[model samples]
Target chain A: MISIPIGEWFDALINWLKDTFPAFFGAVGTVIDWCISLFETVLSWPHPWVMILVFTGLAWAACGLKKYGLALFSLVGFSLIMGMGLWSHTMHTLALVLASTLLALLIGIPVGIYAGRSEMGERIVRPILDFMQTMPAFVYLIPAVMLFSLGKVPGAIATVIFAMPPCVRLTTLGLRQVPHDVLEASDAFGATPLQQLVKVQLPMALPSILAGVNQTIMLALSMVVIAAMIGAGGLGGQVLRGITQLRIDIGFEGGIAIVILAMYLDRVTHALGSRSARKQ
Target chain B: MSDDQTVIEARGLYKIFGSRVAEAREMVDAGHSRAEILKKTGATTAVVNSSFRIAKRETFVIMGLSGSGKSTLLRLLNRLIEPTYGEILIDGEDISQLGPSALREIRRRKYSMVFQNFGLLPHRDVTENVGFGLEIHNVDESTRRKKSLEAIQVVGLEGYENSPVQSLSGGMQQRVGLARALATDPEILLMDEAFSALDPLIRTQMQDELIELQSRLHKTVVFITHDLDEALKLGDRIVIMKDGIIDQIDTPEGILTNPATEYVATFVENVDRSKVLTAGSVMHRTPALATHKDGPHQAVRTMQHEDLSSLFVVNQNREYVGLVRIDDAIAESKKGGRSLDPILQRDVPTVALSTSLRDMIPLAGSTALPIPVLKEDGVLAGIVTRAALLSALSKESGET
Candidate 1:
């Protein structure tokens, strides 16, 4: 049987977007590059010991001091990364994750709230979110490369696309799950729609939104190594270098560093979610 | 009593739930059955052509089984549920056509509601929950705090101000809800099954507390409940609903004595009439009352004229003082007493107008003199005799 060539059609569509929206694409790339570099500069500027001190202090404050053990573990992990000479690369990965996470939140939360409030908005956004989540993570880099070209910006852009679904989906779920009686009570007490959203719905949904943020951060971290292929310099690049040059020691160090960073971010963000959950 | 005294008036209110509301309303107006309309156009009428007026400071109750639309009708008054076709006048203003901001203003200044589940914001502490209404209205912070504290005290939740609502028991949470509504100082309160979620003992306590609060606050209340006893206890006048339609609107005594429909009769069938019928309802006009200045001869004439063995004696202001027996009057006459007050028995049984017949039953059984029903100011409003008490009690058992 004769068949239409889907791959050719996809390529033609990407080419058309690149041709037709060059200025739009360029502006987006510049903005993303600026954000990523700003975070990268700030994160890497401090001496490795200073960075370690700051992160350990934050972990101590968030997860508790002597009792939880996360703070002590973070201190040891950071010291090991510094000893391994992967401090700068680890900072770059963190910067990329932070930048993408911030951007995703800025866009995703408001969209999620809109979807939560309106059935039409939900219906329109649900399929798109499903596609974004279900599509192969690598496929995001294809569009990222076409739009922003190869660099940390494209890598960060791809990470945002791959990580944003959970942020939006969970935010929508949290807001939708606010108890109906509470909303009704707010209405009964003469709360304006804006007042209800700010005072009642948002506070109640805060824990869930934080959970979404946690997932977004974790997803962004997972994308770092994949982003390395697009010339995003980080620990991901070290892993890529180790692979291409057949250096098992380099690959193993890079893998260990990623694991350490992942554990730290996951614990900190999970602690934040739990704190808010307890408050609720 | 007067149009000015009517705090809330609903005229031809209807709430039909479905997409084809207009058609459904038309069918309803044309006398189609609720089930038939549902079958035909997938429409459910929540409140059907209900009309009632709540007087100032009156505890108006709307009652029905689940799906009877009593809650919907309560929401209709505050425009929480938009009526399909009707007008609601809150102090002579038609709220049905009010814009959102205007309606919000009314909600802020005039109407507040308490929910069945004690819908306190789980994140807020008790004080914050109580002050939420004031905060929503943008009241000044200090004043909001003070008023909320006062409301909290009013609901007997003084020490729980900083306690999280989730940490509170069901009764305490409901107190927070009550305090929240009370903090607003709104003119009207719409309570949707406000005590139903509490345990039976707590529910009774809350009901009594609410009645006491209403007496002091004088806020017009529209209470919704499925419990008939609750309706009879709290309602100054009650509207019983069935299948989205009002079956009757009457005082508790009127409903008990003359239920307008079989549905309402059945609803009130199991009610302990003695608990509901009050002293004022069962009392007779004072049989023979003598002023303190009346001579013993006059007391005797009054007792003989009314064919009574004794006579109640009141002062010139009609405040009850004592009772004079026939033998005492004759003895006083023989001794030439100028006033019946010297011969009158001061230890007569007396009850306030609001005392329930159930409570007065024992007093009636113990007393030989007719039970004098006093007004709040101690005036002799009426007297309850043993015969009247027995008849009121007998009506319930006799009917069955």
Candidate 2:
């Protein structure tokens, strides 16, 4: 049977995009790079004990755990990463996750709000969101590599693309699920559209939106080792190096550090979400 | 009422729910039934050609069973649901023609609404929820707090100001909703089944509180409900809706006496007529009353003239003192008493003009003399005779 060379065509399309959108892609690369470096610098500045104290204090304050229980739990978790001697690598992974999550939220939330507010926006976004979510996470790296090249920026970009769907989906769901009567009440009170969004919709939808944020953070964390494949240095790079060199000890240590970091992020964000839910 | 006194007037309002509203409206104009239109065009007409005027400071009720569009009409008044075809005038301005911002301005400044489900922001505490309208109006924080506190007090929700709305009971949540609407002090309040979700006891209490609040605030109110008793108790005039069409518009007493349609008659039928019909409604003219200064002979003469045994005795101020019987009058006159006070029986049953027939029934049945219905000043307004009371009760029961 006569067949189209789809792979070749896809390559051509990627090349065309690179050629046509050099400035746009470069600007995105610079911004992502700047954000990642900024977070890495700040997170690395604290000594290990200082970092431990600050994070524990934050967990204690944010979650309001009695007797500093969550803070103590986070202390053990962070200590495990340091004990694995993957402290710098773990911080790099955290910087990557933070950058990607921040970027995803910045882009996703407004788009989600637009989708929530209008039928047309929802119609246009639904299939795109489905495609973005259902596409293999590895597929994102292909475009990421072509557009921004193999580095932390491309890895962060890929992570953002992979992590963003939940933020968008949950934000739309949250806003849409705001009780119809509440919206009607807001409208009857003569609230401006902007006022309604800021004062009523956002506050009411905070729990769901926070859930979306938590999911995005976890998703970005999960992308850490995978993102290491494209020159993004972190605990992910150590795991990748271990895999290529067949070093079981390095891979095990990297894996352990990633798990502890994941557990810490998961607990803290979940606690934050519950606090918002309680307020609601 | 004059146009200036009409705070809200809806003319030819129609709200057809479907994408093909134009076609549905045409079908509606062509006299298609709601079912037929829903079947043919997949359109549900929520409000159909409803027209009514609410006088200033009057509590106008729109009442109907579920799926009857009474709530739809309430939303239509505030332009929350834009009419498919028609105009609503708020203080003589065509709201349907208003742009988004202008409609919003009217909503913020001229009208506030309470919701059936309470519609309190779950994230907000009672004070924040109550102060929402004022916050929307950009009222200063101190003013908002002051006004919201006053409104909270008005709804008897003091000390609950900082409590989260979700933690409150249904009745308390609705109080917050009411307080929110009141905090704005808007000219009009649109309450869409505001207390329907509360338990019956709380609902009745809220209704009484609203009635008491209305007397003091005197804001033009458009209240929606399915409860006929609430309609009767709260409405100065009520519009009964059926299948998106207005079945009748009349005062509670007028609707009870003369239902404009069979649908309205059925609604009136289920209502407790005793609770609705008042003493003044069933009461007859006051019987011949004698002044305390009148001679006992004159009292007997007047009683003899009226061909009765007993008579109501009032002071010169027309204040009811007691009743006098012909036998006593005769005895006193034979005894040569100048004042009829000796013959007066001061313990006759009395009720007020506003007393419901349900309350007066026992008094009317137990009293030997006719029950005297008094005004606020204790003057005899009318008399509810045994025959009159029986006829009124029978008249209502016979209709159903």
Candidate 3:
């Protein structure tokens, strides 16, 4: 007969989160946000063709041939549709996705490395992640409301939480799964523990870590809808508005847009991950 | 040997598992069998009071079965696992007593290990994998890159620098591992069953590569293997371990010819003694009573070089007659000047055309030199030794 008090439980949950997460990322996030604002300003220049060319080239470099071609077509089509709708919401969503995923990687990878190296860190953090992953999407919207209180920041926060798990889990798993023999060999080769982790373990674990990044991106995309609850306007907000106002056509179109974006991100990130694996 | 000359020295090495290792050792010393002691005290000893020294630049092999602690012994050399009780001195310094940082510095600068699994980093291409150890020492990126490229060439993987390790075959991956070790150019190389995972042909190739590398690099190596043939082929001196104890430590020739104990003898018995036993081993050294020796032909040349030859015939004044052929030596030595092989006395026999004369054996009732007759089998089987013949017959009898 164990009766747990709700207030005590809530306090425990907060304490658990504080203990689990890395403190460095909070500082890193501020700098990253400023950088994102600068990048957005530059991207907003009137000549759209130059930006399109650069993005296409980046896609070509990362994914190569067939995927790059498909991505190019999708980008052109998306631009045409946005032109017809006469809205900049699509561009805003694109910026949000890019900023959030980059931030997720920056925060997730180092924390993953720490968790991988320390058993205690892994034990402390893993259960909290399990809770984060399983919790309803709307639950995060409340914290987004309380803290950032609606807009792009709330959307980004929701995306970060949702997309973060894979990066952490994959990084930890990849580092942990590095062969015992390799570690022994590094030790015998006169490599210090730090050297072994940076040179031996991390490099070997890259493919898997990249896979985690891809998963994190997908999870972050799922949270795009949840972010709309906090009035973050994107395709997800369009869909939410369509549902609330009972406009079937608008909702259906927004759903299609979401699908297109998800597919593009998945292919690009997956290709990037495997490309690194092959280079290694 | 003095401390300076001894590259590796272990004293009172005791690797005891489980909490009550001390109590277990005490019980075992007080007249308990290892099994009884283990049951009573819940401890297992992997290295039991072992001690040895390896000279610099020597190829020292530790040979043992799967559970005999050969790998454990090798691991202890680099302090991968701390010994329950021991001192491991590398170049006169006790490595076992060093701190983690100092131990790491020693590992970075002094030694490198190769594993059977070819533990190349999967995420790194050949050059990157090779450069990893150098990178750890905070070497400049460009220097590490150039050195790693050089190491890749050394292991014959020049074109594979950008190839992922997983894309390579087992043999190629093994080369990457070797290159990774070589990149650091450390003082010692510890190989623990480095070729055991490969196919037989690849194993042989890797062994040859090692021999060639050792000749060039002259790096001190501690090679571990379960295969006696590999041990014989490679070891400058072999340490044969059995059940956590060193059974014998000797040159391959010494171990095969004069095994130290019954355990070692069991291993030596099944081995092809002819291949391992050198010409100097069975050769009978004698005062030169025979003079005026027949012009040394290849037939006589072969007998003269080998230890277990038929006989050396001579005149009363101790002058040499054409050497007595292997089989008819007793009869020919007594009869005086009756040319044994009219053909052999006429011409020198080249060992190159015939397979190793050392490989052949004489059959009972056959003329001693076992004149290798070309066959209805239409092939010329090289001459066999008396030792080979006896061993074959003995094997047959034992089987029956």
Candidate 4:
């Protein structure tokens, strides 16, 4: 095949990026505004320390005292450090991750069920799924900004793009791995296909699908930090401000807050997953 | 036996698995053999032109080695899988042409099946699993639970109602499966190797429990198993299959004594048929009368006291009279000396010097005495235990 001219290829790339940029920026801006509003709502209520203590108590009940103590200490220390720099931004970042992850789950699961049941659907969707998963987090901001303009919305859109793949992939995997004998048993009982899918297949596949949800949450948390460039105000903005102004204290505080938030969400979700798995 | 009503009938049933199942069945029924049909239609046969009728409350067992298509045959009866050709009639009504809704109605009310693997849902507790069918049929929860609890008690699993099925042992899980089937109280119970997965001891226990349950419920059962012993023990009549074709269909005694083919003979060879036969195998045809004045019950009581089947049923004259069966004597006593059908001299079974216990052992449960050791004058010198014939056969066959 004849090679395309380097200048032509570069121009095509630039054109494509320019076309997608506004949607990308726009999604980021919308997400950032939502995050700021969520933080304001949370701030208008009880203190962060009180909520942290309640969560620590829950963790103690779920995972025992040692984990609870460690989690509490980490939360307090991380919050104090972030407080010295920008307290509200850290809370906004936590809200951004939570909101984006919830949105990813809503969209991912039904699509996964569709892909799992039909071979043609899986064949058609898998390549697109692969592309979404492997595309750089920074690259997602381009399309988000193009659609939603520069704000929290663009950031949330980019975070969702970056995070949703795991949920879809895991749900598909779980459904595919459901035991054939178990399916046959349901069929033998005169269960219609829909009843079998809803009652038998989904419940059996819940553990694996939950694992997907956990992964998506973590991925969204990381990507929302990257979305700070599109005027998304959060701990990510603090870290970005620290980098631009060369303020070491602000960067360290923001980074520590993100770690604390990640640990809290992960522990809570995992505990729920295991608890569900243990139930009849 | 001829007066017994038939409850289920299948005519020229064919379950051919391929694109041209209809054509294949036509070709086979039109004088072409299985091989010839296969060559023409390229369809694999599952139940090849098989047909049988099950009488009401009959424990009909389908015995076959794995892949012989006994399971396929059972599914065909309930229409779990449709047959390519044939008509199935339940109580003289053709059910093969029933639509999905009608078929579902039939299944919900008329038939239930127990799977080999004990198909209790893992996520549901025992009570829920047992009541699942009842729930699907729209039985109210309170009624279903009450019925399910009774079924659980019937299966001897009373305390395990709330336990998740995954936590139960294999035999317990199987009992739950049985309870689920029994909970519905359908007219027919179809078991597909239901006991074969259990340990031998557990299998025997389940078999005994099943017999007891059948005795009480009198549900028409079609049990499928590869074990000949199980078939003999549980089946009122057994149908043995080989490669989708039925090789034999008869009572255990009928099949054991007269195997239809070599394949069936091989299956029966290891069976200890003597255990199944009863003490009535060898009674004296003509009993000598005693000096005591009495009827058949009194004669039987007198004889049973001495462990004999053929004793005198006589009047005050002390002349020789008819023989009395010990069983009939016992029956009369149980009924407060009420008259029961007594064993006559003609009704009793007798084996001569040339006879084998292999033939006589089956009559042990009947009115005949234990095998009688006869004198040349045909007088009852002594009686042989059913065990004696078995030992003799064992010695002759070098199986002792």
Model 3 per-residue lDDT tens digits across residues A81-156: 4554623555556667778888889888988998998999999889988987898777777655545445767678
Q: Give candidate 3's error at residue B153 in angstroms.
A: 5.6
Cα shift from native, residue A192, model 3 (Å): 2.8
Better of 1 and 4 by lDDT: 1
Model 1: colliding residue pairs: none
Sort order, lDDT high to low: 1, 2, 4, 3
Measured with C-alpha atoms, the lDDT of residue B72 in candidate 3 is: 91
Q: Is the docking of candidate 1 incorrect, acceptable, medium or high quality?
A: medium
Score each candidate by Cα lDDT: 0.91, 0.89, 0.74, 0.76
Error of 3 at B82 (Å): 2.1
TM-score to native of every candidate shown = 0.94, 0.93, 0.79, 0.76
Scored against the true structure, residue B332 in model 4 reaches a CA lDDT of: 64
Model with the higher lDDT, candidate 2 or 3: 2
User: Could you tell me how far off, in angstroms, the CA of residue A121 lies in candidate 2 after the best superposition?
Assistant: 1.8
Which regions of candidate 4 fall more than 4 Å away from where they truly are? A2-45, A61-86, A115-128, A176-178, A240-249, B1-7, B18-43, B90-101, B277-400
The window of 10 residues in a row where model 4 chain A has the poorest summed lDDT is A24-33
Candidate of highest lDDT: 1
Count of steric clashes across candidates, in order? 0, 0, 18, 49
On residues A37-119, what C-alpha lDDT tens digit does candidate 4 reach at each position? 77557753567677556656666676655556646665675567446755566667777787788788888988888888889
Residue-wise C-alpha lDDT for candidate 4, range B28-134, written one tens digit per residue: 56667667777888987778778889999999999999878899999898888898888898989899999877877777777877889886677789998888768
Which prediction has more favorable DockQ, 1 or 4?
Answer: 1
Q: Model 1 Cα displacement at A279 (Å)? A: 1.7
Go through the candidates in order and give each one's DockQ.
0.76, 0.81, 0.53, 0.28
Write down the RMSD of all candidates, one decimal each: 2.4, 2.8, 7.3, 8.4
